[model samples]
Each structure stands twice: as C-alpha cells, then as structure tokens.
Target: MANLAAVVGIGQTKYTTKRGDVSIAGLVREAAANALEDAGLGWDDIEAVIIGKAPDMFEGVIMPEIYLTDALGCNGKPMLRVHTAGSVGGSTALVAASHVQSGTFKRVLTVAFEKQSESNAMWALSTPQPFSVHLNAGAGGYFAPIIREYMRRSEAPYDVGIKVAVKDRLHGARNPLAHLQKPDITLQEVEESFMLWDPLRFLEACPSSDGACAMVIASEDLAEQSPKPPAWIRGVAMRSEPTMYAGREEVSPQAGRDCAADVYQQAGITDPRRDLDCAEVYVPFSWYEPMWLENLGFAAEGEGWKLTMEGATSLDEGGDIPWNPSGGVLCSNPIGASGMIRFAEAARQVRGDAGAHQVEGAKLALGHAYGGGAQFFSMWVVGSEKS
Candidate 1:
C-alpha cells in the first residue's frame, strides 16, 4: 500500500472549439499556473510533473511533453508522459498521486490537455487500420452501434438519451469553463437535432474542444498544512481489457465493472448509489449516462434507465448521487483532458467549491473514466474530511 495523498489544487482553462489565443505549451501552462496559484505556490513547489493527452496526431505535435518542459516550469524537474487512449487524463492524475503516495515525492504536478483545433480527432480515429472495416465515419459512428445494443438490452426509451443531453447541456450553462453553455437546451430540441449516427443525435454526442486541466497532489502532511480543505484520495484504481474480444461486452465492459468494484472496496463502499454523494463519470455520448449507471453499479442491470427518467442524476434538484454536475464529457470534451476534468470536478465537489453545480452537503464523491473501445478504465474515491 502507498501513503495517503490528497488533491491540494485544481485548475482549468475556458474550454472551447479553438483556443487560438495561445500555443499548445501556453495552453498547458495556463492551467498549471491556475492550479499552482490555487495551491499558493509556484513551479518550484512541484517536485515532479506528469502530463497526458491523446495521440500527437490530434494536435500535430510529436511528443509535446519534450518541448513543453520550460513552458510547464519543468526545466530541471522529473517529467513524465502518460497515455491510455481517452482515459489518459485520469491515468495521469493517478500516476502523480502514486508519486506522493509512494513517499517518492512530497508534491507532484499533473496536467492533461487536448488542442484538437490543430487537427481532427474523429478523422484520426476513423483512419483505416489493418483487419478493420473502414466505416469511414468518426467516433460517433463507431460508438453508435454499441449504444444501440445497450438500448435493446435494457429496453430504454429513445427519450433517455435526449433527457441526458438536455440535463448535461443545462448543467454546462452553470459551468463557465465548459465548452458548450446551452442553458435553454430542451429535450424536444435534442430529439429533433440531426442524427450523426443511428440512435445517436448530434446534441447527444460530446463536442471536440481545446482545453487543459491540472492538479497538485500532495502527501497527507503537506495537505494538512494547507489552508483549504483537502480532497483526500481514499481509493484509486485502473483496469484494461482487450479492445475487442470474442466474448467481450463493449456496452458494459467487464473492466469498467471491475474498476468500480475495486475502488469501492478500497473505499469501504458496499452501495455506490448511497455511499457516494455524487459521481463525475465519462459519458461522451448521452446514453452513456445510463450505460455507465449499470456498468458502475449505480443502478441494477436494465434499471439504470429509470434513474435518468426520474431525474435522480440531475444536479438541479437531484438526490445524493447526482452525476456530472459539471455537465460531463457532453459539455466539455478536450479528449485528453476530459477525464482529468471529471477527476478535478469531483475533487471540487468534495471541496465544496463547484459553484452553481455543487451537490448539497457532498462529502464523498467518485470520479470515473473509460476509453479505447470502452476497454480502458480508471476511477477514484475522494472525500472532504481528512483521515
């Protein structure tokens, strides 16, 4: 086991389709600087650095970390890069936490970013590969079929995806940093939106944006010395399965189920719905809200759809387990940074500083992410009280 670690600071840039105002290096520094400022420190305070993002093709940059050294104030510090498909953001954070938990570093800086404006992620993903049928469509086309399978398996209504789209978009309006701020988005509008993929409407899908997220992870001693409440890292876990296997279940990946179970067990949770106050999960597509509910054990199989139908996951007036109060991946998806945003937002929730989307009296929260054909998974449990 590793030593206790806590998130001391979190930060992000205003997410949008294009951040032409800054270069890739500048984008990451902007977020890192914000986190450092929140932690009441500077570059010197961080003992090491870890950064993550999608493939370099997404930004037309080859191994960005190599050139971002000075930009991130890592000129002479140990810097590492992490990649795990879309889960890279959360994985990066977990790696930084490991440094502090292992007693190898007292404080570590972790950042994840994506500048998709430089290129096209969907095109990069849809590029033909050997032994693959070239549907020639982007991610929406790839995921739409799996979503259809979920609908059939759970017998979910068509409105389920629309409801989630509306809910998360509304939530985005409350988040100043989210890419999309559609406060007036309505379910009917989402239903009528053009379909990108069968059963997957445009509004139901996540946006491609440019953004970055950063966090300062520190040991318990350093966290206790800080003025702000520390988001204690109670548990952290990551798992992966083959991208495609004969018996694999993409809609409800076993890796996702196992990841949640491992984190819950480590955090002393038996009932996720009640034990955790809220969850910031990776839901790039609207239907994933219910799909993840089943995968993460928030609801029983074939019953996750009812939760969305009843508004249990709504931050506006939901119960203890509201999901993605920050609007989730649907609102702000900077591919590499999406998972880190979820992780950071979860920390913000437990820290009681999520602003408009804050869950009332939230003390404990969960952050989850999955990627690469829903094969890679990462999750963590955070709490307000130090232990």
Candidate 2:
C-alpha cells in the first residue's frame, strides 16, 4: 500500500459571476500562487501539476491546461489534466494525493477552475447532443423532478427547501471568498424568490461562478518540514455508474452511498454524524443538503429532512454535524472547481486555517462531490492528526 499524504497548503480565488479582468491562465495562477505562499514555499518546490475541469467547451478553449502549464509553474514538470464532469475537481485532488502517497513525488500541486462568464451555462447544458433529445431546459429542470420525487416519498414539508437555502446563504456571509454573501437574507426572502423550477427558487440554484481552487499535497516526510500544519488524508474514494440505469433512484443515489461507505470504511468511521467534525458537501441545490444526509448514512432513509428541520446542520448553537460552513456550492459554483473547493475547505478546517468559517477544534472532516445525474461520486476524509 502507498504511504499517507497530507495537504500542506490550500488557496482559492474570490468567487464571482464574471471575473473579466483576468484570462483563464491568470485566474489559475492567482490560486496557485496563494497555495504556494500558504505553504511558505516557491514554485521550485513543486514536483508535478494536475489540472481539472468539467469540460473544455465551458471555457470555449479546448485543452486550456496545456496553455496554462507555464502559468501554473509546470514548465518541464509532469502535468496531467482530468475531466469527469463536476467531480473532476475532487478526482483531480485525489490523483495528486496518490502521487505523493505512492512516494513518487515529494510535493504536488492540484488546481481546478471554470470561467462560466465566457459562456451561458443554460445554453451549454441544453445544447443538443447526438441521438438524445434535450428534454430538460437546464440543471434546475433536470433536478426538479428528482426533488419532487424526494418530496413525495418522504412527505417533506414544502418549506424545507427554503430553509436550507436560507441557512447556506447565511453561512456564505461568513466566507469572504464566497461569491454570494447575503448576510441579511431570511427564510421569507428565499420563499418569496422567483421559482426557477418546481420546489426550486432562483436563490436555491447555484450561481455561475468564475473562480479556481488549488491545493498542495505532500508525503508525510515532506509534510513534517512544512511551515503550516498539514491535514492528513485518511481515506479517498471515487465511484461511477450509468447515468440512467434501471432501478436507479435519482433522489437518493446509490452511488453516493457506496462512495461514502467505501471512504468511511477506509477511514474507520462507523457513524458519520458523530465521527465527523464538519462536512463540505456539494449542495448546488439546497434540497441536496437533506438528500445527501440520508445517502451519506448520516440519517436513515426519509429522515434526512428531520436534520434540516431541527437545525442540526446549522453552524449555530444547538446544532451539531455542521455542513458547508464555507457557504458551499450554493454560494459559488465554478462547476469544475466546485468539488475541489469542498475538499480544500475541509482540509482548511482540519489545518486550523479556515479564516472566519473555521469550526472550533475541528479534528475530522468529510469532503464530498457528485455529478452527471448523480451517478459520479468522489469523497475524502481528512483529519488534523496523521492517521
């Protein structure tokens, strides 16, 4: 088996709807430099670079990573580009960690991003594909049915979605790097927002953000030499199934459950709600907060909504098992970089480096991501102390 790897540095750009000031290369470089600075190291210290994103078409530039090699300081260094839809960010980080865990590289840099301002996401998603009819209008259109099914089966209250949206947007207010920091937002405001899809409002959907997130992973030996404390990787896993398979449950995806189980077993977690200090889950739609709760084994089937209703997922008093303290995907959706942001945020909490959103004395954290009809799943567990 390979040796354990730890995150020595984490960095992300200020997320926004349109970062027209910088080119894609410039945007990635900004995040890479911040990570290097946080590690108290320089580009000369990096051994390899791994870049990931949803699709090249999103940025209107094919194989943009090739042109960004120089910007990421990958000149003459081994470089790899990964694409697995929205899970690309988390998978990219895992690939970089593997290199260090294998003892093949002392230090590795991983980065993920999206320049959604260059194109409209609705058009990109609705674009016609060969032999397939474009039935759904956009992501909201595709997911609305699943959300409706969840509501029907669970008999959840109509206000549950609105509550989740309010909570995440409130949490986003605490994160300076978040794209939408609506501090004064209220539940009533979310309910009053325009409905984008049935049971999904305009505020419930994630914004098309232009941003990048980067991290530096190193072997145990190299981690001990780093200036900042490292967040040790306990377990990592990725799983995929057909986008639309027979007997598939889109509302509560089995792929997510299997992915979580694999990681939990590897990390020796028997009960996620009690074992995990905090979680950074992919919540592009607010309702996912509860859906993922059951899928991740935090609650029994049909009981995920109880956690949200009782405020157990909040960061405030009387709440436990806080989720998305970094405002999560609802605050920023760079698509390609979204998943890595979750992983990086979890690492930050464990490293005791999460600025204002830091969970007090956080020791263990879960980072999760899913994409493509909820068929692709990637997850990782990180802890403050080496496992």
> Would you list the C-alpha lDDT of every candidate in the order shown?
0.91, 0.91
Candidate 1 has what TM-score? 0.98
Q: What is the lDDT of residue 37 in candidate 2?
A: 94
Give one digit per residue, the lDDT tens place, for model 2 in 1-387.
769899999989999999999999999999999999999889999999999998777777788877999999999999999888788899999989998988899999999999899866677667787899876477788889899999999999998889888888878888999999899998889889999998899988898899999999999988999899999999999999898878887888878889999999989999999999999999999899999999999999999999999989888534788899999999999999999999999999999998888888999999998888788999999999887
Q: How many clashes in each candidate?
A: 0, 0
**Candidate 1 per-residue lDDT over residues 272-299, each given as its tens digit:** 9989999999999999999999999999
Q: List the residue pairs that clash in candidate 1.
A: none
In candidate 2, how many clashes are counted?
0
